[model samples]
Target: MTQKNNHTIARSWDEFSEQLLGFIISRIHHKEDAEDILQEVYLKSINNIDKLQEDSNLNAWLYTVTRNAINDYFRNKQKNKETITQDIFTEDTDALNIKDSFCCLEPHINELPGKYKEVILLSEIEGLKHQEIADKLKLSLSAIKSRVVRGREMLKEKFVTCCKYRIDENGKLAGEPDCQRPECNH
Candidate 1:
């Protein structure tokens, strides 16, 4: 509506954004996509600020908006797409070398059995607790823990192979382009 009213809403939104983002991201499978959707939520909220009633609960309104946005995203994709491929390697061209490294790692991750891949991503990337991952996946805690350990080991072995490093003889890392991370002291 008015400039002052818009400013108040934007300020209120800023106060709530971080907590809302964390909650929304927890439900979403992809962090990058979650961010994109969150941006859409902001734009929608700003544009519809006039429609919000004086008595409405802002927090509930925001949650409703976020949920609807997520639903719409899934619905639009479902309408267009057939079988979904594992999209482990998305375009991240800002750091070309880092993206290339991820591109190299993605195939190994994708090649793993589905359960293992899910366990690894939930544990490492999302930083979910074992119990949380277990609940989300509807598995026992011990089962989740075991899968995470096994998945990590499998990934390590695959990475070592991709690097072409001699595990026993040569203490040095391999000469493969993927193995040369600037941060790796080894």
Candidate 2:
């Protein structure tokens, strides 16, 4: 690339980082994930710097890249079928029915053998793309995709089973129990 083009790319990147960061953050709820997406955007922009022309349109180009990344993230998430484990461990144990209703999903996640757990965590928690997960795990794209699918199904079944059997001593439904769990109290 010419020096002028290089300067333009650098300037445009710096000017748009803040807006791009916010845009990515809004799409992905986690702050850390948003930051990681921003980093990916920077890397992608740098690698494709040759295609960027006309300084005025730089913002639009950057946004397009971001939209693509976000779409890829969601598509991978759906392919993976990963359900976020709602954590409710810190609350009072007096509501064992409720506690049992909401057991720690980390254990279930831990049960996933091999890269399935890693793929699910990265795709769901870290908001990474399939390609990103493949790169991170040094596995083939097909392998990553497969793991996400099977792993998510396993988690869903596990969560459903755990939630179903949860009942108070009085045999009442956990959700309609006479008392509230400490975590839900607030």
Residue 129 displacement (Å), model 1: 39
Evaluate candidate 2 by giving its C-alpha RMSD to the native, one decimal: 9.7
List, residue by residue over 1-186, the lDDT tens digit for candidate 2: 678767876898888889988998888776876787888888887788788766558779889988888887767654433224222222233454444433334566777876778887887655688899999889899999898878766765554454432333442222422323343332
Top TM-score hit: 2
lDDT of 1 by residue, 1-186 (tens): 789668967887889888777867888777887887888888888888778888888778888888999888776554322111112211321233333445445466677899999987667544568999999999999999999778766765665666443332322222333464444323
Clashing pairs in 2: none
Alpha-carbon RMSD of each model = 13.2, 9.7
TM-score of each: 0.44, 0.50
**Candidate 2 displacement at residue 47 in angstroms:** 1.5
Candidate 1 stretches with Cα past 4 Å from truth are: 83-186
